[model samples]
Target: MKPSKLLITLLALGVFASLAFGQRRNQIEFYGGAAFPLAPETFKDYTKVGLSGNAQYVLFPSPRLGITFNVGYEAFSTDDEKFTDALSTEFTGQTASYWVGQGFGLSPSATVKSNLLRIGAGVRPYLTDPEANTQFFLLGQVNFNLIKNDFSAKEIPYQYDAVNDQLFFLTFNDEEY
Candidate 1:
């Protein structure tokens, strides 16, 4: 199944299970947010920020301790326009043996995307008294990710005409993360 659909199914199951627990202090939560690529210059050069959604089940076994299970999904597509411009710019004023003394121009289009499914467990320890209206806690988690990528394009191989100095579509390459 699609990752997003699986996430929704799991979330629905969690909601039903939460109701079955019958008045316990345990909780089921749904949350979502966005992330922006940063720090690594290469990552920022090719990715646009994407939003993510998650479902979490927190089990309060004691007044100060909670165990958590979570599942989430996020995806990002390649910055195609920016990447193509960069490629064209880089190839400009360049010649290759295959060019046969006439440099070929590049005009390519592509769709490169990546998706992630994260599943994990963690422990959260409440710092303040349980009776307090507000509390702080520390959490530690270990996660496993199921990742998928859609690297596809609709374009033919780069074709160049040496005699007439003409160039047609350029080939699309898979750029993996």
Candidate 2:
């Protein structure tokens, strides 16, 4: 099926389920948690940690069941200093030798950031009686995500010529998707 058609169908199903169940109570909840990347090995040189938050509105058709609509955002960032430290540790001797031979010094800086937005519909089933002050529930959701990534870096190399008594400077800037 086409993407647009599939979206419409899913929306219709959500509406049907809500109507069929009948609304008894309405609630809004806000929640947040730490996020961990699934593939840590893939990003071996970098530390990966993220934070996510969501707001959900639930319609309880019956005490035992509820239909939920949710929207959420998540952000992750990797520090360039940590990356530089890793590289320096791995190639310290080689880098020193190269710099001594070339009569120059090198400095590098970089940062990477990523973001995600999610929209979803789901069902929450209450395990305990709804009248209870505290309830345990299980949630099942289907979500659509919009994602973006950004990377930026700067490198500078400098050298001094004793005979010429002149200083040379070079700069590079890089930005990527």
Candidate 3:
């Protein structure tokens, strides 16, 4: 058979199979777990621990195959920014600047933090809850990754000479990014 014809035949077969296995109802689930940062530089090593939570709603409009929609959230922060700040501060020529523009002085820098959100779809063979009002169902699911409350970049560094020997700045202890 021609390639296009064969592709159409396969798609029709899939739809037929789904109708043959159709269940009557739908199911939804709510759950939360821990999130691990998979990216190396995006999140701090092991420091990006966070919470994962989502709601999955399944639509078993037919039988064998159902569609799932998942909406989820994951919160995280990385260690690279913290490490970078520390390394920069340790450099010999780098001085801490007291004010925003003051630099090459005893300027304190902070790390960057981030929150992520996730969203996706999935399929399951069987899903049911006899006790629920609905009956005969398949499970559909989705996963979502969302990034909320993104942190701002640290202040840019500038140069200062001995003409401005005095450096006085006030920073709040609770400030974090």
Off by over 4 Å in 2: 1-23, 40-47, 82-103, 156-177
Among all candidates shown, the one with the greatest TM-score: 1
Clashing pairs in 1: none
Candidate achieving the largest lDDT: 1
Residue-level lDDT tens digits of model 1 in 1-177: 999999999999988776655334888999999856563576568778877889999998666888899999987656865555454445543223233334343335555576679999999999998788898999999999776655544332244556976665455445633
Q: lDDT by residue for model 3 over 66-134, one digit each (tens)?
A: 677788877665564454444344442443332434433444554455677678887755455534555
The lDDT of each candidate is: 0.68, 0.67, 0.56
Candidate 3 lDDT score relative to the true structure: 0.56
Query: For candidate 3, what is the TM-score?
Result: 0.50
Q: Which stretches of candidate 1 lie over 4 Å from their true place?
A: 1-24, 38-43, 86-107, 156-177
What is the lDDT, from 0 to 100, of the residue 127 in candidate 2? 96
Cα-based lDDT at residue 159, candidate 2: 49
Question: Which has the better TM-score: candidate 2, or candidate 3?
Answer: 2
Alpha-carbon deviation at 8 in model 1, angstroms: 42
Order candidates by TM-score, high to low.
1, 2, 3
Error of model 1, residue 20, in angstroms = 18
User: What residue runs in model 3 are displaced by over 4 Å at the alpha carbon?
Assistant: 1-23, 44-47, 62-64, 77-107, 127-149, 153-177
